[model samples]
Target chain A: MEVKKERSNNICTLYVDGVLDYSTMEPFVEKVRSIEEGIEKVIVDFTDLEFIDSTGIGAIINLVHEANTKQFEVELCGIIDEIKDLFETIGVFQIMEALQEESD
Target chain B: MCSREFINEQPREINKTLEREIKLARNIQMKLLNGKQPYLENGEVLGVSIPARVIGGDYYDFYVLPDGKLRIVIGDVMGKGIPAAMLMILTRGAFRSAAESTHGPGETLTAMNNAMYNDLRTLGSFVTVFCADWDPKNNTLTYANAGHNIPLTVTSEEDIAEFPKTKGVMIGGLPDQEYSEESLELDDRGFVLFYTDGIVEAQNKDGEMYRMERLCDVLLKSYQSNVKDIKESIVQSLNIFTEGVPQRDDITMVLLKSR
Candidate 1:
C-alpha cells in the first residue's frame, strides 16, 4: 500500500493506494501512528486502494482503535465501492465517519 | 432478502432451473435447532454449525445416536461450494455409521478421514472434522477434533475449558492421519460451543476483527442463558459491532448445553 501525506491549515490528509493486506498492516499502521500526534483529525483517502484481505482488515481495525484511544478524529474518504463494501460489512462506518463523495 | 418468484409456471430449461433453485435454497437455508439435549430440559438448545461454504464447509449432522448418545458432527470438505457439499454428504454418511457402530468420537473421525481422503484427494478435496458426544449424567463430554476448531466448554463451575490439544492434519490434506481424543469433565449444567474460523475472522466497521477475544467475552457472558438467546445476542452484538460494515465472511456457531 502507498500512503501520501498532505497538510493544509489544520488538516492532515493521507492518500492510500494499492493492496492493503496482512503483509502491509505494520507499515500501514506505523505510517498513520507516526503522524497522529501532530494532527487534530486524520483523513485517509482510500480512492486508489484495490484489494484488502484479512490482515489488511485487521490493520484498519488497529487504526480505528488507535485513533479512538488517542482521541483523534479519523475519516475515510474517496473510497471505491469494492473496498467500501468491505468496510461496510465490518461495521466500521458506524463508528468512523465516511467522506461521502469521490475525490477524482 | 429480495426474492423474486415465478409462481405456478414450470421453468424453461431444467438444468438452468435446477441451478437457480439450488442457489436460492442455499441463500434461504437456516437452522432452527430448538430441543433439549443431555443436560438441557424440555426447551434446551444444543447445536453445531459446519458450513459447506468457506465458513460452513461441512455437512453437519446433530442427532441422537441409537444408544442414546448426544451425537454431533461437523466436517468440512476439501474445497468450497456444491462439489464440497456433495463430498460432505458422502463424508457424513461414513461418520454417522461409524459413530453408531464404533461409538468412539476419535474413531469416527479417523475412519471417515481415511475412507474419504483418497477419493477426496482425487477430486482435489479434503475434509476437517470434529465429532463428539455430551454426557449429562456425569456432567462430562468427550470429543475428537480432526483439524477443526477447538470446542470450548462453559462449565457450571464457570471454568472455561477448551477442547484438549491434539496434533492431526486437516482432513484431505494427508492420506494417513491419526486423531486423538480430548475429554472435558463438566460441572453440573454446562454446554459445549463449536464454530468455524469465520467467527473469529469477522471484522467490525473500524476494520478491526470481531476476533477471538470478543467472541470469548460473549461466550462467558451468555453461558447461563438459553442457546437461542445466546445466538441472538451474539448476532446482535456482531451487527452492532460492525455498525455498517458489511460481512466479509460467513458467521456460524453451535452451542450444546449439558444440564
Candidate 2:
C-alpha cells in the first residue's frame, strides 16, 4: 500500500492507496509511527484502499490505542461500504469510540 | 581452530532444537483443536481448521452440555504464528471452562471475555468469536457473536441467508462485554456453515479474492449433501479457485446439518 501525507496547520492527513494486508502492512505501520509530533489531529483516508485483512485491522486498532496514549484526535474518512460493513462487524467503531471516551 | 568449529556447530544445534520445539508445539495445538467431535442425536456437526503456517491462531471446539445441547465455538485471534497460537490456547481454556457453567451462548462469551480480557488487552491483541448451541431435540440453533462474521444458513436449494444480526465488541477490545443471542429454527434438511474470513478472503494468482458470491453459489449446490461432503465440496472449490496460491490466513469452518 502507498501512503501520501499532507499537512495543514496542526492536522495531518494520510491518503492510503492499494491493499493494506499482511504483506503490505509494514509501510503503513511505519507511516503511522512516523507521524510527527505537535499534530493535533490525524486523518486516514481510505478512498483508494482495495482490501484489508485482519492484520491490517489490527494495525488500525493499534493506531487508535496510540491515539489514546499520545493524546491526538483520529478521524477515518472515505470508507467504502464494504469496508464499513467489515469495520462495523468487527467493532472497530466501538473500540475507537471507547478509546476516544477514555481519552476525554 | 577448535574454538571456531565449536561455535559453528553450536549454531546448528540451536537451530535444530528450535525447529524441534516448533514441531512439538504444532502437534500439541493440533491435538487440542482436533479432539473428538460430539455425536448429535438428529444432526451432524464437523469442524476443520487449516493454518497458514506451522501453527495458527484460529480455534474451534465442541462441548456437549449436561442438558444434551451441543455448544460450538469458532474464533480467530489477531496476528499469526507462535504468539497468536499461545493466545488461542488461552482462549480455548477460557471457552471450555465457561461453556461448562454458562446457560447460553451469550453468557458463555461474556464469561470468556471476563476471563481473557485483561491478558489480551495487556498483550495488545483481540479475538473475534462466534458461539452457538445446537439443540437437536427441537431443531433450533441459538448463537451469539463477538465481532465475528455471521454464519450462513441454507434453507432451500436456491436460497441462503445470514444468521440474524447479533453484535458485541471483540474480546479484548473492551472489558466486560455482554454478547446478545439470536435464535434460528432449522428445517430438517437445513445446513449452517460457520467460517472464518480466510475462506472468502483467499486470493488467487491474479490477486483476485475468492469472494462470497462464489462461496454462496458453492454452498447452494452442496447444501443437499451430508455435512462432510458439503465441507469437502467447499474445500474443493477453494482449491480450484486459488490454483496453488499460498493462503494468507488460517482457514476454519464448522458445519451443522439437521439429519
Candidate 3:
C-alpha cells in the first residue's frame, strides 16, 4: 500500500492506495504512527484501498488509540462499501466512537 | 578446540530446542481444540481449525449445557503466530468459564469481554467472537456477535443468508460491552455455518480471494450432505482454489445441523 499525505492548516489527509493487508501494513502503520505533532485532525482516505485483512484493521485500531492518547481528531473517509461493511462487522466504527467518547 | 566446537553447536542446539517446544505447543493446542464433538439428540455439530502457522490464534469450542443446550463459540484473535496462539488459549479459558454460568450467548460474550478486556488492551490486540446456543428440543439457534462475521444459515439450494444481526464491539475494543442476542428457527435439514474470515479471504496464486459468493454456492450444493461431508466439500473447494499457495491466516468453522 501507498500513503500520500497532504496538509491544510491543522488538518492532515492521508490518501491510501492499493491493498492494505498483512504483507503491506508496515509502511501504513509507520505512516500513521509518525503523524506530526502539530496536526489537529487526521483523515484517512480509503477510496483507492482494495482490500484489508485483520492485521490491517488492527493497525487502524492502533492509530485510533494513538489519536485518543494524543488528543487529536481522526476521521475515516472515502471508504468503499465492502471495506465499510467489514469495518462495521468488526466494530471499528464503534471502537472509534467509544474511544472518542471516553476522551471527551 | 573442543570448547570452541561446543560453543559453535550451542546456537544450533537452542534452535532445535525452540523448534521442539513450538511443536509441543502446537500439539497441545490441537488436542484442546479438537476435543470431543458434542452428541445431539436430533442434530450434529462439528468444528475444525487449521492454523496458518504451526500454531494459530483461531479458536472454537462446544459445551453441552445442563439443559441439553449446546453452546458453540468461534473466535479470531487480532494477530497470528505465537503471541496470538497464546491469546487464543486465554480466550478459550474465558469462554469455557463463562459458558458454564451464563444464561445465553449474549451473557457469555459479556463475561468473556469482561474477563479478557484488560489483558487485550494492554497487549494492543482484540478478538472477534460469535457465540450461539443450539436448542435441540426447539430446533432454534440463539446467538450473539462480538465483531465477528455473522454465520450463514442454509435451508436449501435456493435459500441461504446471514444470521440475523446482533451488534457488539469486539472483545477488548471497549469496556463494559453488552452483546445483544438474535434467534433463528431452523427447519429440518437446515444447518448453520460459523466461520472466521480466513475461509472467504483465502487467496489463490493469482492473489484473488475465494469470496463469499463461491462459499455460498458450495454450501448450496452441499446443504443436503452430512456436516462432515459438507466440511470436506468446503476444504476441497478451498484446496482447489488455492492450489499450492500457502495459507495466510488461521481458518476455523463450526457447523450445526438440525436433522
Candidate 4:
C-alpha cells in the first residue's frame, strides 16, 4: 500500500492507497510509526484502498493498539463496502469503537 | 592450473550436496502435508495444499484425539520460500506437541501461541491458523481461528454459502492470546471449506483478483460433487480466472463433508 501523510496543527491523517497484504505491511507499519509525537488525532483514510488481507488487518490492529497505548485518537474513514464487511467480520470496528467509548 | 581445477570441483560437489538436501527437504515436507486422512464414519475430510514453489510456508495437518475426535489445522506463515518453510516446520512441531496435551481447539491454539510467540517475534513474523475439531457422530464442528479466513459452508440444495464466524488475533502477534471456539451442526449433505488467502487473492493478468465472491460461486456450483471433485472444480476455476499467471502465494484447502 502507498501511504501519504498530511499534518495540520497537531493532527495527522494517513491516506492509504492500493492493496495492503503481507508484503506491504512493513512499509505501512513504518508510515504509522513516522507520525510525530504529541499528535492528538490520527486519521486513516481508506478512500483509495482496494484490497486488504489478514496481515493488513493485523497492521491496522497494531496501529490501533499503538494509539491506545500512546493516548491518541484514531479515526478510520472512507472504508469501502468489502473492507467494511471484513473489518466487521474480524471485529476490528468493535475494538475501535470500544476504544472510542473508553476515550469519551 | 591443477589447483584451480580442484577448487572448482570442490565447489560443484558442495552445490550438488546442497541441491540434494533441498530436494530431500521438499520430499519430507510433502509427506508431512499429505499425511493419512482420518476415518469418520459419517463424514469425509480431505485437504490439499499446493505450494507456489517447490516447498512453501502453507501447512495443514490432521490428528486424531484419544476420544476419537478429529483435530484439523490449516495455517499460513507470513511470506514464502525458504525462510517461511523453516518456520512452517517449527509451527507444525508446535501444533503437534500442543495438540497432544490440549483439551480443545482453543486450548491447542493458546498452547501453540505461547510456544511460538517468542521465536516468531524474534524473527519478525506471524502465522494465521484455523483449527477445528469434528465430531462425526455428533455431526458438530467446533472451531477456533487465529486471524484466518472464516471457512465457508455450502449445502447441495442451496445456491449460496455462509461463513462460520469465529475470532482471534493472529498467532505470534501477542503472547498469552486466547481463542474462543464456536460450534455448528452440519447439514447432512453439506461441506465446510477451510482455505488460505491465496485462493481468493489470486490475481489475473489485468491485476484483478479472483476474490471471495467468485470463490463462493464456484463452491455453490460444485456443492453437489464429492469433496475431492469440489476441490478439483475450485482449482479449475482458479486456473481460468488467473489465465495462466504465475501463482504468487500458496493455495491450500481442507474440506469436511457430512456424509
Candidate 5:
C-alpha cells in the first residue's frame, strides 16, 4: 500500500492506495502510527484503496486504538463500499464509533 | 580448520533439520485441528482447515461441553507463516480454557479476549474469533463473534441466505471487549456454515474474487448434501474459481446441519 499525507491547520489526512493485505500491513501500521505530533485530527482516506483482508482490517482497528490512546480525533473517509461492508460485517465500525465517542 | 566438504554438508544438514521441524509442526497442527468430529443427536458438525503454507493461522475446534452442548469456535490470527501458526496454538489454548469456565459463547469470547489481549498487544497482533454453542435438545444455536465474518445459514426449503447478526470487536483490539450473543433455531436439513475470509476472498487467475455472492450460490446448491459433501463442494467450487492460482490465505470452515 502507498500512503500520502496532506496537512493543514493541525489536521492530517492520509490517503491510502493499493491493496492492504498481510505484506503491506506492517508498513501501513508504521505509517499510521507515525503521524506528526502536532496533528489534532487524523483522517484516513481509502478512495484509492483497492482491496483489504482480515489482517488489513486488524491494522485499521489497531490504528483506532492508537488514536484512542494518543487522544487524537480520527475519521475514516472515502472508504470503498466493499471494504466498508467488510468493516461493518466484522464490527470494526462499532469500535470506531465507540472510540470516537470516547475521544469526543 | 573445517574441510570444504564438511562446511557444505553443514548447510544441507541444517536444511534437512529445518524441513523435519516444519513437517513436525504441520503434523501437530493437523492433529489438533482435524480431531474427532462431534455428533449431535439429529445433526452433524464437521470442521476443516487448509493452510496456504505447510501450516497456517486459521483454526477451528469443537468441544463437547459437560451439559451435552457442542461448543464450536473458528479463528484467524493476524498474518501467516510460522509465527501465525504459533499464535493459532495459543488461541486454541485460550479457547479451550475459556469454553470450560464461561457460561455462553459471548462469555467465552470475553474470557478469551481478557486472557489474550495483553499478549497480542505486546506482540502487535490480533485474532478474530466466532464462537457458538449448539444445544441439540433445544434445537437452538447460540453464538457470539469477535470480529469474525458472519456465517451464512442456508435452508433446504428456500434458496435465500441468512447471515446471523453479531456485534463485537476483534480479540485484542481493545483491552476489555464485551461480546453479544444471538440465537436461532436450526431447521432439519439446513446448513449453518462458519468460515474464515479465505474462501470468499479466493482470487482467480483473472484477478476476480470468489466473493460472497458466489459462495451463497454454492451453498444454495449444496444445502441438500451431507456435511462432508457440502465441505467438498465448497472446496471444489473454490478450486474451480481459482483455477491454478495459488492460495493466498488459509481456508477453514465448519458446517453444521441437522438431519
Candidate 6:
C-alpha cells in the first residue's frame, strides 16, 4: 500500500493506493494516524486503492473516529465507484464525505 | 463377412461412450450447487452450513459412516472462484487419497495447510480451514478452526456458545504458527453450522444484515432441527431481510444435524 501526503493552505490531503488489507494496512494505518496532531482538515483520496479487506475498512473507520475526536473535518476525494460502494455499504459515507470529484 | 469388423468397432465405440458419459457426469456433478435444492439442505433453520459449489472457495461436506461416525470440513481459499474450486477438488482428492492415514482433525488441517501454503500464497492467497472428525459413536466432535469466522453452536433458548479456534492461522500466512485443537459434545439434537462471512455480511435495501445473532434467533424459534425447515427459515428471512436488494456478496452457509 502507498500513502502520499500533500498540504496546501489549511487542507491536508492523503492519497492511498494499492490494497488495504491486514498485511498492508499496518503502514497505511500509521501514516493516517500520524497526521492527527497537525491537520485541520483531512482529505483522503482513494482513486488509487485497489482492494480493501475488513481490517482495512476497520482502519478507515478508526480514522473517521479519530478525526471526530480531533475535531478535524475529513472528506474523501477521488474515490472510484467500486470502493465508494464498499464504503457506502459499510455505512462509512454517513460519517464522511464520499466525493466523486473535487471542485477546489 | 461384416461380423468381425462390426464386433471390433463395438468395443472402441463403447469405450468412447463410457468416457463421454464419465465426462458428462463430472460436469453435472461439478454444478452440484447450480442455484437449486437438494443443495439447500438447511431451510430457515438454526445453525446452517451452506456449502458453496461442492468444489468452490468455501467447502464443508460431511456424512456419517455406517458404524455411526460423523465427518466435517470447513475450508476457505486465499482466492475466489475457479482457482479456489480447483484447490477444493485437490483437497477432496487428497481426502480420499489419505483417508486411512489422515484420521485426526489436527493432522488433517496441518497436512492440508503445509501443502498449499507455499503455492497458494505465491498467488497472494491463503485459506482458513476447520476440519473436524466427529465420532458420533462417542458423541465427540474434534475440530481445528483456521482463521475463519468463529462457528456458533446455539440452543433452544436462543443462546449461543462459540466453539474455540484451535491451531490455525490464515492457513498459509506463517509457516511456524501452531494450530490448536478442540472438541465438543453432540449429545443433544441440536445443529452445528458453518458459513462464510458473505452470509452474515449480506445486506438488504436498508443495509441491515442477515447477521449471526438474527440467524441464531431463527434457529432457536423453530426448536425443530429438521434440516429443511431450518434452512428454509434462514433463506426466507434472508430474502425478507434483503427484500428488493440485490446480492451484495456471494452468500454461502452449511448446517450439520445429529439424530
Which candidate comes out best when scored by TM-score?
3
DockQ of 2: 0.75
Tens-digit per-residue lDDT, B53-119, candidate 6: 3224555555343444545666555444455656656655544443345556676666666666676
- Whole-model lDDT, model 3: 0.91
Which regions of candidate 5 deviate over 4 angstroms? B1-12
At residue B103, candidate 6 shows an lDDT of: 57
Task: List per-prediction Cα lDDT, in the order shown.
Answer: 0.62, 0.91, 0.91, 0.84, 0.87, 0.61
Which residue pairs come into collision in candidate 5?
Answer: none
Model 4 agreement with the true structure over B1-259: per-residue lDDT tens digits: 6456557677878678668878898898899888888777878889999998888999999999998889999999877777878989999999999999999999999999999988976765778888999987888888898877788888665545555677786777666878999998887888889999899989999998898889988888877788889899999999999999998889999998988
Writing each residue's lDDT as its tens digit, candidate 4 over A29-91 gives 888989899999899999999778656776777777678778898899999887887676555
**Stretches of model 4 off by over 4 angstroms after superposition:** A22-30, A37-41, A61-74, A88-104, B1-25
Error of model 4, residue B131, in angstroms: 1.3
The better candidate by lDDT, 4 or 5, is: 5
> Compared to the true structure, candidate 4 yields what TM-score?
0.83
Cα deviation of B118, candidate 2, in Å: 2.2
Off by over 4 Å in 6: A1-104, B1-56, B63-68, B94-99, B176-178
* Deviation in Å, model 6, residue A84 alpha carbon: 23
Writing each residue's lDDT as its tens digit, candidate 1 over B98-159 gives: 77676678777777777777776465445557777766566556777666667677764346
lDDT of 2 by residue, A1-104 (tens): 79888899989898889998778988888889899999889999999998888878888888888888889988999999999999999999998998888887
- Candidate 6 lDDT, A1-104, residue by residue in tens: 88988888778888898877656887777787678466788888888887675556656656765666677777878888866754553345643442212211
Candidate 3 lDDT over residue span A27-74, tens digit each: 887788678888899999998998888888888888888899889999
Q: Candidates' DockQ values?
A: 0.02, 0.75, 0.78, 0.23, 0.62, 0.04
Clashing pairs in 3: none
CAPRI-style quality class for the chain A–B interface of candidate 1 = incorrect
Cα displacement (Å) at residue A49, model 2: 1.3
